[model samples]
Structure formats: structure tokens, C-alpha cells
Target: MADILLTAVINKFVEIGGNLLFQGGGDLYWFKDDIDWLQREMRHIRAYIDDAKDKATGGDLRVKNLLKDIQELAGDAEDLLDEFLPKFQQSNKCKGAICREFAMQIEKIKKRVDDIDHVRKTYNIIDTSNNNNDCIPLDRRRLFLYAGETEVIGLDDDFNMLQDKLLDQDLPYGVVSIVGMPGLGKTTLAKKLYRHVRDQFECSGLVYVSQQPREREILLDIAKQVGVTEEERKDNLEDNLKSLLKKKRYVILLDDIWDVEIWDYLKLYLPECDSKIGSRIILTSRNSNIGRYVGGGTSLHVLQPLDSKNSFELFTDKIFHFDNNDWANASPNLVNIGRDIVGRCGGIPLAIVVTAGMLRARERTEHAWKRVLERMGHKIHDGCAKVLALSYNDLPIASRPCFLYFGLYPEDHEIRAFDLKNMWIAEKLIVVNSGNRREAEDLAEDVLYDLISRNLIQVAKRTYNGRISSCRIHDLLHSL
Candidate 1:
């Protein structure tokens, strides 16, 4: 992740420098040389990370710890620049003392980079030159989606049960939560149910409330998605939302909620319709406590891992592109190896997806497959966090922090789009060509969508125009 951070920091330095250049102010020239120097230092740090990503995932405690340190330093550098940007924008003409102070800070940042390099060399970390691991691009290009026609083996029964709960017209309103460990398919199951019953209501939408949810923003988003016009969306958003949905039969999916407090806030706006018009709220959470808190009267649905047979089927389908018949074409030795790899996944769907993806590009030989099994042995049994880290490593460096920042929120938190975008902008993680706060926010949104496309993040809710309203980080990814 540090490698990813260093990469982002370098790019940010260049972007800030370019922005300064656009001002064409003589006082800003002082930063030109400093930005160039920071870029150079970042390149030096990049040398140590050539193979750091692979080693970090190799289950070496020492290597992972080292990368954590680098990630922190990179974060510091990012925070510093965030402070610098507004100041720079406010006064392109620097005061004599201010210019000197800015220069000192740049020097300090340079020294920190140098110190990190020295530590990298002391570890004797080798820079490997193999970029041919073509499993998946660390970007949205490799986004995975569960096709509606796709079979989820044991999920059909669970889906049907959930559908009955959601579509039960007997209840005027209720809350149903799907609880499980990270990557156990809670969100997947909810998605299937949401799609199945969404249209049955007068209005419906899925909203993600992550660890650090902003109550007001999420409420605004809910209101917008349920038909609140921009002109009518001002002031007392929650009140407005309640009024709008008071008479309509609606269903809202609150995915990956971390705390009951969030529900306490959102439930106010989601009114209970008349007895004849049943409305419902569906939530997915890792915490059973959350389910208990919001369950109203129904029992919580706990998702168990796939059985061994189902796990192998999922692995084979993913690796073979869902063509189950293709399995016969592979050598028997490879088939045995594939099963062994699936065993290492512990029946987690995300683990199966990532492990199969990692193997998708390897040579289809017993020896090559065995080598992957060896690497899998290093971290496979650890937990979903380790398994999910593979996907995190696959993320392009620029997107890692943007993704990891989601972990900062508590479990089951729904993050607001406005706050999220502003946070990224303040950290200088967003790249905006227009150099305006409004445009920078739009670009930040694109980054969020990129994460969503990669399935690194989940949408909780959307605005009236279909823009994402809130987002969620998987509990496993949050743990990472």
C-alpha cells in the first residue's frame, strides 16, 4: 500500500505544481523547484516498492509492517499538501516570511522521504522486474458483477426466503437485516432481494451507510432519490423526506450499516405507510447486534459460507468463465490443484473470486498451479482481511488510499457523498483538471465510481438523478 501511496503523492505533487503554474504568478515560482524535488524523492521511494506489493501479500509480518510505516508517511505528505493548496490558491503572491516558511516545510518533507529511503535500503528489499502478472488490472476495467442468470448454488433458497420476508405484504413496515462475516455474500443477497421487490413499492432505493455516516447528507440523498426536487430539498431534509414518503409504499435497502445510531437517524425519515400499503427497510450488517437493534420483530438472516462442493463450483466457474463444461478440458492434476486452492479460501465468495482471478493468468500446469498453492498457504488461512488484501493490492496505487480511507469509518457506517468528496479533495487525492472545488468534487465522484466499478465499494443510496448518494466499504475491506 505504501508503494501505492508514494505513487499517489508523486502524482499529486505534479498536479499541485501544474495548478500553481496556471496562476502564472512570480511568487509561486518558489514552489516549482520544491515540487520537482518531491517528485524526484518519490521516484527514489518507488524503487524499493517494485516488489513490495508482492512481498507484503506474502504474509511476511516484517514486510507488511514496513509498508504500513511508508503508508503513514505518505499520508502525512498528502495532508501537508492539502493544507498547502488552499493557502497557495488564496495568495499566489507569497509574503517574504511565508515564502521562507513554505520552503522550510518542503525541506522537511524531503528529509522525511530520504529517511524512508534509507530504511528501505537497510531492509535489503530487492526490486523485482516482473510486471507480467496479468491476472487483473488494478482498476475499474476488471470490475466483476454477478449476472442475474448466474447460479449462486446454495443462495437460491436464502434468496427466496429473503424475498418472502421483503414481499410479505402482511406487515405495514419492518426492518430485516442479513448478518454475516465479511465476504459471506450479505450484500449480494440483499442486492438480489432489492432487485426482486424494488418495483413492488411506490418508491425504492438502496442506501449504503458506512462506518462514518453523515446523517443529514444521507437523509438528503434519500429524499432526493425518493423524488424530492432540488428546489424542495433545502432545510429540514429529514422532515421533507418523511412527508414525501408518508403516504407511499416504499422499500429502502440500507447496506453495510455499522452502528444503530445511523439507523436511529434514518428511520425517522422513512415513514411507516398505512396498513394497506406495506413499506419495508432492508439492511445488511456484519454485526448481529445491529440486526437485533433494528429487527423490529422478525428474526435476522445469518448467511453461512458455501459448502465445499459449492466453493469448488464457484472457483471453477470464475476461473473457467462460468463454462462448467470447460473443466473437463483441464488436466486432472490441475483439477486436483484447483480444489486444494478452493479449500484454502474457507468458502468466502470474495476469496474465491480473488483467488480464482489470481490463478486465471497463471500457466495451467500442475507445477505452476502448485506454486500458487504454495503462495496461497502463506496467508489463505489467516482471515478474510488477508484474502481481501489481494484485491487491495490489485488496486492501482492512486486508488488505494481512496479505498482504504473507507476503513476509517466504523463497521456498518454509510458515508455521505458530499463529505466523502470533500475529504478526498482536502487530502488532495482527487485530481481535477478544472482546478475549482465544484469540479474537483465531480472528479472525486468519478474516483468513487471507479471504486464502485471495481466492487471495492458499494452504493448505499442515490440521488434523484441517479448519482450515488451514499457508499459502503465491505467489512473485510474495512478491516484491511
Candidate 2:
């Protein structure tokens, strides 16, 4: 709540300050002192804003009120610039006149800052200077490996088989697809295998091709990643990409593919012939139809849910964090409750992970864990929404809108990252990082990756050069 609002305000302040300092140029250079002061003061206030956000999450009313006032003050500052900048630009010989025009308003701006400072001091809002504790920083290259280490269980055989298939020289240039229902970790396994085998290729890239495939963009990405350079021209993207990879041994990973048509389009650029040694196309799809369509016979690997033993390992590890002493000392009644909860997870990796996260945040009591187990019904009766909601609740307040925006799309819709970046900006949903000169779209991409790291959304497709081409929201998350 209040944290989201304050974060939005801080982003706006930084955006406006950046525009004034850089884009204002000589037209308003006389106000350098004012701009510098504003920037410095804004930077100073940022620490307190973050501190208040942490405290505000605990439901502190005073901190909430302070955040509201700070948001208003930030809005006022932006309004002053919005009004003054355009008028100044429209006027002839306006530099001196603009400085004079903003003279009084500058004082008002400083006074607002002072008022906010007074409020910060009065409330005893100490700058703890801690970053958002909720967002777990993720490295893209190591995402699946991290999941495997922390949450994945009993996939050694699956991993070995997939790895063997990828390395088999007999099928140097062909498609390998992974098919399964949602939450079965198809994307996770694909990622792990891709990272493992990619180094062996001359050029390797992973792209996400979601339900709604953008043929031109995807082809262009593949071309770029495989070492092809193209200008603004779009006349022969597929042909150009094909020609580039025609002689090279390349590996490409496509994730969350929803249609055979997507592969058919991408296949135009990718060489799928016996001549291309060590080149492979690996993909993951939820639809079994897509698997049959792309690789007609025996090429699809149908992912299975964790078996009972593996499920228990994952559940207990999440609940107890591998503390053998803790598990050993537990009462028989509590141990039974643990088994009941794991049983209710129904061997689904996602269900176990979400349940564990929720309970781990609660009091470690038999009664508390049992209550969760009871609420979480068996098999289909276990509402996927409830499990997802627990995961959603764990996200930083600043990250929620970015995750919820997925709900706006139709079920099974494939969302393009470029379109999503603009949409996030148009909706004013993303918070810009201070001192970050990257475009707003880049910041939005960062937010998307954060969601991906939290397993909230799957990377549906990426470009050959390692940029996210498209994404897919879990159908259950769409219900949320």
C-alpha cells in the first residue's frame, strides 16, 4: 500500500528531476542552483521514504499518513514543472523570464520539502537504509539452478535423460519439446538443460515464444543472437536469420510455446538439417498438441509431477529447511500434520513450494500447520488461487501491480515484452530506479524478471540475443 504510492512518487520525482537537469539545457540553466538543490534534497528524502515503506508494511498509521503527505508533496513538485516547463518553452527569449516566473514557486517547492523534513523528524522516522527485503534478487543465468538447489526434488533422472538427448550427435539438428500441465516445471527443466548444453555450441540463445507469436520480432532476435546484423529494414528477416545460421552450429531454447504455428514460423529461420552439426532447438509447451505438431514422433518429453518420496523431501525441506534435529524432535502429531499437508500438495512442485513459503512465514506450531493443511483441500479441491495468493502476498508491495497486470490479458494469451513495457509505462505502474539512465522499458523488463524469479510468471519466449520476447501468465494467476 503506502509503500507502493511512495515508490511511485519517488520514481516520478526522479524522472522529473532527470528531465530538468539533462533535457532542460540552456533554456533553464540559470536555475542550476534550484535544480541541484531539488535533486540533492530528493535524494536525501529517498532514504526516509524507503524506511517508512518498511515500517508502513507493518500497518503503522502514522507512517502511512506521512507517506501520503510525501506523495502529495512530490505531486506538487511535478505539477510545478509540468506547468512551468511547457510555458517557458513556448515563450520567446524565455530563459530570464522563466527564471523570474518560477521564482515564487521555487520557494513554495523548498517550503514543501522543509515541511516534509519536519514531518520526517517529528515522526522520528529513522532511515534504516535497508532495501526491499521481499524481493529476492535473481541472476537470470542461474535461475533454474537456484530453484533446483532450493525447491526442486527428484528430477535427477529427468535431468539426465534430457541432457543425454540434447548431447546426442545423432539428432544434431532437430526439435526437442517438453510437454506437461501447468506447475510441472517444464520451463525450469528446459532452462537448466539449455544452460548446461549451450556452451558446447558455436552460438546459443534462448527465446520465449508464447501463444501469440510475433514472427518478425522473434526472427530478428534469433538473427541478432546468431550474429546477424540488420537495419530498420524488415523485408527479409526470416531469410536473413536463416542465412546467418545456415553455416553455424547453434542451439536455441524456446519456452512456453503454445502453438505449432509459432515453431513453424521460427523454423523458417532455424536450420533443421543433418548438415548442421551440434545445432538443436529445444522448447517447452503446456499443450500436448503443440508437442505432436512440432516433433511428430518420440521427440516430446512429457513432464511428470513429483512422486511421493520426492514430494515429502521437497515439503519437509521447505518447512524445516533441512534441520534434521528439528524434524527429529517434532511430535508424532506434528509429523502427521506435515505428511497430510504434503499429501494435499498432490505431488505438484508449485503447490508444495507455495504452501511451504506460507507456513514458513507463520508460527511453527502443529495447530498452525494443520489449519493450513485443512484449508488446502486434496487434489483439484485445492484451489490453485489460494496457493498463488500466498506467493503473491510474499511479493514486495512495489512489485504487485507488475504481477497483477498479467490478469488484464485473456486466458492463454501470449504477452510481448515490448508491448508490456509500454503498457506498464502508460498505466504508470513501474517505479524508476534513481540515477538509472536506462529507458523506462528497461526498468519494466527488470520488474518482469523479478516476477519471473519469484515464479509468478513464466518466460514464454525470448529473442536469440537473450532478451525476453514474450511472457505467459499462469492460468491460475489469471484467476487471481
Candidate 3:
């Protein structure tokens, strides 16, 4: 236990040191130095204590003194960190540096305590032959792609079909399109599939082309997924993409395609598949026409909203997660209200997940759930108008108009790149200089993409040609 605690303390110190150096703009090297010195001192003291324990002849007093000294040093280091942390947090400019330092300091203290516990456990072991403690399993940390407040439910058949298509070696076309209405789990389904089949493929990459589909952005995203690190050099996106795809059987998931031109360009870059290795491309979009165009007469996989039972089950899972199975036991009325709320979500997984998350932290009450259900029902009347209205109301006054202008287009209608830019300019919403219209357009596109990413707008469609043609609001989202 003592050893574990000591290791934990050292680990914490290392973490803080690294965080401070990196997050502080490389201005906190001295903090790292201090941590390093403390780690060395702790290590030496631990070694002396261990040696004294092994040699059990008249060294008890010496060991006790050494342990006291180590405790004093640890406490002093912790005190210093606590004092420094608040000061750094208070200082606007030094906030990042201070946070990094504090986190590292706390982590070190935790590790030391853990080490102490581990040592005690080892010493108390009854059977030396059964020394399983030495064989501690390594922590398997997973890579999680968090789809904020979005749920993928009741699409098992669609998900399986797409999986089969990707796994099929004899399929004529490498590109497969998953078509759906906005907020209908197109991206979520793709994400689920990617995670499932990621290990099967030689290399797999999921690029979120949710922004204004600039060819450069697409290329950069693909390059990053395929492990390209060099930056600042100018090159055509197609050339870069083709280079990344060379000799690799990769799954390139192009999310939110908007224009046909993007498909034309992408088609040129994707390698022609053979028997041994075949590269696959997956696209998600709102426009069935674009999906058909990209699929080249292939069957389009349309994602439907969740059914009532699935919606309730998804909501229940989000809030309860298997612990609170007896919904009838804990506020039955609230459970009924929750069911009502889920029903009002119109089987949309995104709405149910977000609403469930919001309700999770609140008290389970009939009144609360009733109010939420009523609000959701009101919002659904206009296909997310009320929900979006609420969200807009919650936003700072400055960002409201910027959000509402996005609703001028019809549902699943792809707002053009230049058109959105001109609207922002005409509205005087964005600042411009040197009459660089392209730059202004890029900024406007960025703002729109940010809103979409934030769940304010749903990315409806993307073209293989690399354009965002349309966007829509979730039924609940539009209400705001």
C-alpha cells in the first residue's frame, strides 16, 4: 500500500508537471523541475524505508524517522500546490498554468496514498505462493467518440445491413450511402458502425465533414485520420486524399455530404478495389437524390426515427442505466410523465437522449416531467421550432439572430456556401476587411458549422463533391 501510494504521488507530480509545461505556453518549466526534485527525494526515502524493513535488526527508529520526514515533505509539497493553484486560477492569464500545476499536485498525493494501501495489502497477504497481487491487470483505456446528447436506437437492421455491405468483398461499388432526415441518427449510425468494424479493417477513419464542405477541410481531415502530420504546405485536396488512400484498405466515413460535385471529386480520389484489398467509403445525407447519385443506383439505407417502445427504452437506459429497474417503485407518476415526454419526442433518439440527460440530475417528480413533456409537445408542433426557440432564448442576445437566419431554408434544403456568406454580409452580422469575400464566406461557414456541431442545427446533406447543401432543426430543437 505504501509503495502504491508513493507511485501514485509520483505519477500525479509527473502529470501536473507535463500539463503545466504544455498548457502554460511552455512558461512553467520551473514547476516541472520542482516536481522532479520532489519525486527523486521521495524515491530515495522510500528505498531507505524498504531496506530498513528488509533488515529487521535495530533499524525501527531509523525507519520511523525516515517515514516522518517523507510525510512532512509530501504535506509541504501539497500545501505549496494548494496555495499556488488558487492564485493561478484567480489570475486570468495564469489560469491554465495554475490548473495544470494543481491537478498534477493532487494526482501525486493520491498516488502516494494508493501506494501505502497497496503495501499494507501485500504485507497482510497470508499465502506467499498465491501472489496474484503482482499480476495486476493493465487498465484498458478506450477511444470514445462522444456524440453529444445523441442516441442511436432501433436501427439494428439498418446498422447490420450497412455492416454487411462494408464487409462484402464482391460489392461492385466501394461507396455506400446512409440517407436520412436531419436529426435521424445518420451520423450516429455511422459512428456505431465505425466502432464495430474499426478493428476489422486495416485502418479506419471517421471524418466529421459537418462544416461547409471545403475541399481543403475534407483533405486535411482525411490526412489526419490516415496519420499525416505535416502542415502549411499547399496541395490539391484530391491529390492529398489519393495519396492517403494508396495501398490502404481503409473505411472513409464522409458525414453530411451536400453537393454532387463533392462526389465527382471524391470518386476520382478513391482507389479501385481488387480481390485482396478494397477501400470503402460511407456517406450520410438528407437528400435521397444525392444519395442515389453517389450510390450509383445502389440501394440507399434510410434511417427512421425510433419507435415508442425503443424511444422509452433508450430514455430509460440513459437515466437509469440498469440500476433503477423498478421504475414503478421510485415515483411511478414521474415514470409515466417521462414516458409521455419520450413519446412527444416523436421517436427521435437525439431528443430523447438530451431530454433524459437534462432530467437525470433533477428530482424525480410528476410536476417536473409534466412540464418537460408539455414543452416538448409544444415544440413538436413546428418540427423543432419551439425547441430551437427555447435554445435561442437561452443564448446571449448577440447569437439569437445569427441562429434564426439559419431557418429560412425548408427542411432538408441545403443552404449554399456563397449564399450563406452573402446573407451574413448583408445582415451585417460578420465583420469584414480588405473586401476578401472568400475569407468572409469561410468565417460565415465556420459560424454555421459551430452552431450545427452544438446541436442547434442538424447537418442534413453532403455531396461527394464536397458541399453542405442543406440543414434542418430537430423537431424539439426547432421549437427553441
Candidate 4:
């Protein structure tokens, strides 16, 4: 009787692949049990491969061949199970939910495989691969909807200030710095200004120099933005940049700069335009000192958080999908709770977007709103901190402390790369190579660039010497 029951279960699974297992609501628990069995089988297959590798360490050719054959069979079985397991047992009712979960799991598996493959391919695992060399330039021609319609949200007045500086042919060398907290919309404002007046300048370019700012990568980015061919970059990077921008009225936007040294290197390439020929450098940073260092008080625009109405509107757009009527008609208690939740977001656009996304998926009920309000603090922390943490977690373990070290700096404090890297070396966060600390320092900078790219840190400004003079975190983000 037990054997017959087992045979019936196996046949059911084979016949319907478990899709109908829950349909009749009869003994669906066996479906999970069967999937677990397959998982156990995969584990055993992996163990066999490990055993074979250990036994063949003496270079036994026949054993090695036999092990390879067994490994291939195990791999095929694993692959077959992987293909059928989801179809057989997992919930297929919600495509979006299932696909998202599957994608995340697959991504984890892919990263693990890639890491193992990298180890197999290279005898030494160097941290140099963490650099932004793989970073690709965003399409400047494509309009980003993050900014939304200009009529709904008024233009940031700073855009006009940058436009004036960029178009002023009589101004010899002008540097404009847009100072703001993270998600207060520095990049959005810069993009708006760039889109509006990019054509006015003889040459225009925008490069997002994320936290792990690389001079070579930045120069390469500039080269690409201004139409410098791959062949030109193959030649001297600096020389190619100088040749491309010299004597042209150019508007170069160095977005999210972290290292003042980037400014130092970039300045060498920028033409020293006379009063008759103008060149503009617009930068965005969360640190005021960065603004002072980069802009020298001449062209600095400080961005303030939005007012209650704007903040509410931003939140509403994200949560209610711009259906203001639905939100307005919601129960007064529910609406108040929602408003309170938005207030905690501190007018940070990213925070608002993340929080509102969570709320949007939930039912519009008093109980639901209260639940969100009750957990508002934790939610805000996760939203702000986790975005930054994603970049930190992605970093190699060796470079992780280099990032956490930034926590020592007070919120909104400007950080200089030279002093920071030296501190990292002193604290033993950096690794030295061949009596040259350059590689270690370079890696540290890459870590910084990674943070900046992830929007955790903001580039303040570049000094006259062309290095990142300062950096700061958004206050709300820093609180996280």
C-alpha cells in the first residue's frame, strides 16, 4: 500500500509537473516534499564531484576521466531539475512576483559562478577589477523621466545660473558648483540645464564620476562625450583630451566628483581660455566646503529641500500615481497618516520614491496606513541606508573598511582624497604593492567612486589645482 502510494505520487508529478497539485486542494504538501528530494539529490551529486576531485589529486588519468564523466552527468541532472522544479512546484499564479524572485536568485547564482570562474582563471585575485572600467556612459540624448514635466515642478533656478556661466563667452574660466544633499535632485537639475543649453556651447559634455572616480575612466568618458574616437583614446589619454577640448567653448559637467585629484588632472586638459573665449565647469556636491573649494564663491548654487506642498506632491505622484483625487478623497485619518509618513522622508526624492513604492503596493485602508506609519522609522532607515549599503556590499571585502571609514567624517563634511587615502594606509585599510602605494590608493579611490556612483556620497567641487577638494553625505542619508 505504501509503495502504491509512492508510485501514484511520482506518476502524478511526472504527468502534470505538479501544476495541478494544488488545484484540487488534495495533499499538496507532497509537491514541496518532492522538490526537496530533488534538491537533496543535487547536493549528493555535488558531494560526489568533491570526492572525485579529492581522490584524483594523484593525477590518476583513468580516475580523472571517470570523474569528468560523472561530473557531466551530475551537471545535466542538476540542469534538468533546475528547468523543471519551478514549473512543477513553485507558485506560477503571479508572474511578476515569481519572475522577480527567480531573477534575484538567478542573479545570486550568476555572481557566485562568475566569482568562482574568475578564481579558476586567475592565480591571484587582485582588487583592481573593482574599478569603474566596466562603467558605461548613459545616453545623453535620451530624456530621463525622473525629472518629470517642467510645468509640474518648477525649474531649479540654478539651471539658469549655470546656463549664464556656460554661455558667457567673455568669462575666461568659470566653475559653477551645485551644492545639495543626496536625492535633493542635483543630478536632475544638472541634466535639465544640460538638456536646455547643451547646444549653445561649441562643445558640451557630462560625465557621472561615481564614488570610485577613476582619472583614466573620467578622461575616457570625456573623450567619448566629445566624440573622441576609440583610436584617439588608444593614444595618450591626456593628450587626446587636450587636443579635443582646446580653444573650443566647452561646457563640461563633472557629476558626483569625490577626489580633488580628478579636478587637478582634468584642469590640465581644459584650455586656459582668455576673457574673449569662455569655458565653464559645473559640478554638484553635497558639501558646502566642496562648493567653496571648487567654485571659489563665484558660481555656487545651494539646493534646499522642497516645501510641504512640493514634498506632498512628489510623494503623491509616486504612491497614488499622480491620482491626487484618490488621495484627497481617502479617509482623513488615512491621509494624515500618509502625510506623516511622507514628512519623515525629509523631502529626499529617492527616499520618497522608495517609500512611496512600498505604499503603492499596499491597500489604501486605515489599518494599512497605520501599519506603514508604525514602521515608518525603520522603513526610512532601510530606504536610505540600504541604497548605500548595496554598493558597500558589492565591494570586495578587502576594500569594505575603506568605505566604512567614511563614517568617521561628520555629516556634510568635505573629504579630501589625499588625506583620506593616507589615513586608510595608516589604519591598514589599504594594501601596498612593490614599494608603490599608488595601486592601493587607486583602489581606495575606486571604492569612493563606487559610493558616489551609488548616490551615497556627493562630489563637492574641484580646487584650482584640479583635485576633488571635498565631499559630503546628505544629512538624512548620513543619518542612516
The number of the candidate with the highest lDDT is 1
Task: Please give the CA lDDT of all the candidate structures.
Answer: 0.71, 0.68, 0.60, 0.60
TM-score versus the correct structure, for each prediction = 0.52, 0.48, 0.48, 0.51
lDDT of 4: 0.60
TM-score, predicted candidate 4 vs. hidden true structure: 0.51
Residue 415 of model 3 has an lDDT of 63
Q: Write the per-residue lDDT of candidate 4 for residues 215-313, one digit (tens) a residue.
A: 777788778788778888887777877876775777777776555676777778877644345667778765455656665776667776677777888
Tens digit per residue, CA lDDT, model 1, 121-226: 7767765332444353333211222234334655888998888877766633476778776677877778778877888888887666654566886787677778
Residue-level error in angstroms, candidate 3, position 43: 75
Model 3: worst 10 consecutive residues (lDDT sum):
136-145
- Counting clashing residue pairs in each candidate, in order, gives 14, 5, 56, 19
Taking all chains together, the TM-score of candidate 1 against the true structure is 0.52
Off by over 4 Å in 1: 1-151, 171-173, 273-276, 322-325, 379-480
